[model samples]
Target: MTTEAVLDIAVQALMVAAKLCAPVLVTALVIGLVVSLVQSMTQVQEVTLSFVPKALGAAIALVVTGHWMISTIVTFTTDLYTRMPALVGH
Candidate 1:
């Protein structure tokens, strides 16, 4: 394959990865911010307080978004497989 084709595939893979990760990352970030604010307000800064909620938020995000994530990845994989012959021949 041409350099540009290879680069395109690489970029697409990166985008898919980022898309899959964004929900969990954003959930963790928002939860962490809220936990930080609460800790600041209450003067109760237990490490687990922040850690647990962010973890739970991430898990919840994964649970909520799991179907979409799987479908996206499956679509990408199917497309890649369908293109494999073309990609390998040249």
Candidate 2:
């Protein structure tokens, strides 16, 4: 309800979002870099060569971390809900 409370909620939401996205983002970044390196070394300048690996890596990352990501978001939501009354001074 207050400025500080609103800022706190906003920061927490952003943190949760970053935490949720980190795994897949990191995977894609790494995959892209590696694919680029391999393409350079082999002189294979195919778009799908880079794209497919990054996509598959991201998909695998999502699969591996999906449950944890869901649980983390659920926990954040539940905590936010639990603090709602206090946050609203109700």
Candidate 3:
């Protein structure tokens, strides 16, 4: 409706997106760091070692946090949809 309202919604969307993605991203980052450290210590230079663990960590994070992420997104969407008429000044 108003510029402020639009900006507020945009910011909220971004915040929610970041919140939903944080767990997976953080898990992958940590796993990669650990794998790299291990590689450095052991002199094991296999690329797959780092890649596979990070991928699996991200997947497991998704599995564990999937419901909360979906619920947040659904609630946001539903709230937006419910307010559409008012947002349009109808």
lDDT (0 to 1) per candidate: 0.95, 0.95, 0.94
Summed backbone clashes in each candidate are 0, 0, 0
| TM-score of each model, paired residue for residue | 0.96, 0.97, 0.95
Ranking by TM-score: 2, 1, 3
Give residue 71's lDDT in candidate 2 (0 to 100). Answer: 100
Q: RMSD to native for every prediction?
A: 0.9, 0.6, 0.8
Once fitted onto the true fold, the runs of candidate 2 whose alpha carbons sit more than 4 angstroms away are none
> Model 2: how far is 89 from its true place, Å?
1.3
Give the deviation of candidate 2 from the true structure as CA RMSD: 0.6
Report clash pairs, candidate 2.
none
Q: Write the per-residue lDDT of candidate 1 for residues 1-90, one digit (tens) a residue.
A: 778879989999999999999999999999999999999999997999999999999999999999999999999999989888898884
Residue-by-residue lDDT tens digits, candidate 2, 1-90: 899999999999999999999999999999999999999999999999999999899999999999999999999999999999998798
Q: Write the per-residue lDDT of candidate 3 for residues 47-79, one digit (tens) a residue.
A: 999999999999999999999999999999998
Native-referenced Cα lDDT, model 2: 0.95
Q: What TM-score does prediction 1 earn? A: 0.96
Residue 79, candidate 2: Cα error in Å is 0.5
Global fold similarity of model 3 (TM-score): 0.95
Estimate the lDDT of model 3. 0.94
